[model samples]
Target: MVVDLVVIGTAITLGPLHNSAFILLLTAERGVRRGLVFILSWLAGLLMVIAAVILLTGGTPPARQSVPSTAALAGKLALGLGLVAYGERKRRRPPRPRHAPKWMERPDRVSGWTAAGLAILLQPWAMVGAGAATAVDANLSSIASTLALTGFCVLATSSMLAMELYTTFSPVAAEAKLRGLRDWLDTHQDQAIVSLSLLLGLWLVADSIYQLVE
Candidate 1:
């Protein structure tokens, strides 16, 4: 469970879409406030999912080979296969001219509420689902299990937290660097998505299969 959380957390942190959106928010007018709104919303979404799963399971994993256990693994398997298919399709499709979304162009105009909405909208939900599925195995009675879930949330949100803090403290410096990063992410977003999807998909697929068989 710890291993799964680490991998999924890393993937979420490094995801192109949210990071790109976040960079725009950070560099926009009133960016620090907007960025804070985004980070809080993003963290809230993750917490909600994790809390829901823990509640449903009574904070203990369903027994191995039990129906609930099998179902969780199967759900993860399906999600993994879906990601793999999506990645392959993107990889095989003919390249087209990529343009930044219009919304990205006017980050300065985005309201705090809208920035909050973007956070919810831009989450890598498939990966978040995978994380929730892994959290199924969490035995919260154990300090490690509890800490793992808490740690996973922090780790996943760390990137945005760091960016927001940097921008808040050193606006002039962060703006130039963050804009450069945003442009790079925009240019390479598709490639990043494809790579992340395949790598994480394969990992989830293999791990799910191994657990199911064991």
Candidate 2:
């Protein structure tokens, strides 16, 4: 239970903090409400993945048990390559034109609930990781473990909500920071994405190789 809580908490924190999906969403959207909405959409997407994983793997061994196999290693390598390729593609793409919608330009027109729900749904990796962790804990048939998993999810979500609120309210700071980032991205988007993708791919390859060796 303790282990499950720690793992899940870490996954949730990392997902919101450094996940490319969240960063891309923030980069694309300028307003606080939109940013929140994007996150909610991401979360909602994640929930769908979670539900699917739970339903499919409910009676199966944990992913850790399955992912260390030769087949899994190959799949991970493929996934790593795919991620690298995706990042490279993003880098090569031209900048999109910005056109503000009438609704988006109005501060009072945004829907908070919708945004929250959507953000929760869209981040599929976070959802799957959290769900898998929760499932493993649940399989232990310990009420304490279950409670801890739930607590971790709630705490992580709360932390994200707080951060989003702070970011949204600080328009001047947020805009300034985003403007600087945008300019940087425009000049070095491909290099940045490719570098990150390569690093992540290397990590994946190393992990897979270690699993095979072990």
Candidate 3:
């Protein structure tokens, strides 16, 4: 039970950060209300993913032995290259002035429930991790343990929320801290995200190749 909770918590933390949808949603909104909504939606998506994975894998957690083949390696590499190229293309594009949405423009009118739902539905990674966890623990029947797992997920995600809150409430201070990092990223944005993509892709490719060879 402890192991399961730890695994679930770690999955939630890592999944949401890298999940494209989660990042996009977080970037699109401003303030704690939006952040809360994103968290709700993220959790919802995660639950759904867990359900699906459980169904597909017959309630079995994906074992390391289930890794893909060499051909899969080539595919992962191609996918990684494609992602890097896309990031480069985006970097080259000029930033358009952001237009505030009607609701966002009227901050007082925003609905927390709606924000939470939308954020969760938009992200895919949350769903994947949740699904995987659900699959792994399909037979586990400890309600208290399950609740503990959920609590850990919420706690893990709080890190992102805390960061957002800090930036929103203390813009001057946040900006000061971020200034150097932002400048560095601006100067090497393409290379940075691309390099990250490549590294992740290579890791995936190598793993797949190893699985196939074994």
Clashing pairs in 1: none
Considering every candidate listed, which one attains the maximal lDDT?
Answer: 1
Give the poorly placed runs of model 2, Cα more than 4 Å off. Answer: 1-30, 59-71, 84-163
Quote the lDDT for 44 in model 2. 57
The clash count of every prediction, one per candidate, is: 0, 23, 7
Worst 10 residues of 2 by lDDT: 15-24
What would the TM-scores of all predictions be? 0.97, 0.52, 0.49
Off by over 4 Å in 1: none
Sorting all predicted structures by TM-score, with the top scorer first, yields 1, 2, 3
Q: How many angstroms is residue 133 displaced in model 2 relative to the true structure, after the best TM-score fit?
A: 12
How would you encode candidate 3's per-residue C-alpha lDDT over 113-172 as one tens digit per residue? 766755654443422333243335343365664565466556546545655676678766
TM match of model 1 to true structure: 0.97
**Residue by residue across 27-99, what tens digits does model 1's lDDT show?**
8889899999999999999999999999999998999999999999999998899889999999998889877
Per-residue lDDT for 22-131 in model 2, tens only? Answer: 33344344555566676565545544544554465463435554642355456655655665677667667776665533543443444666445445544435223434
The model with the greater lDDT, 2 or 3, is 2
lDDT per model vs. reference: 0.93, 0.50, 0.48
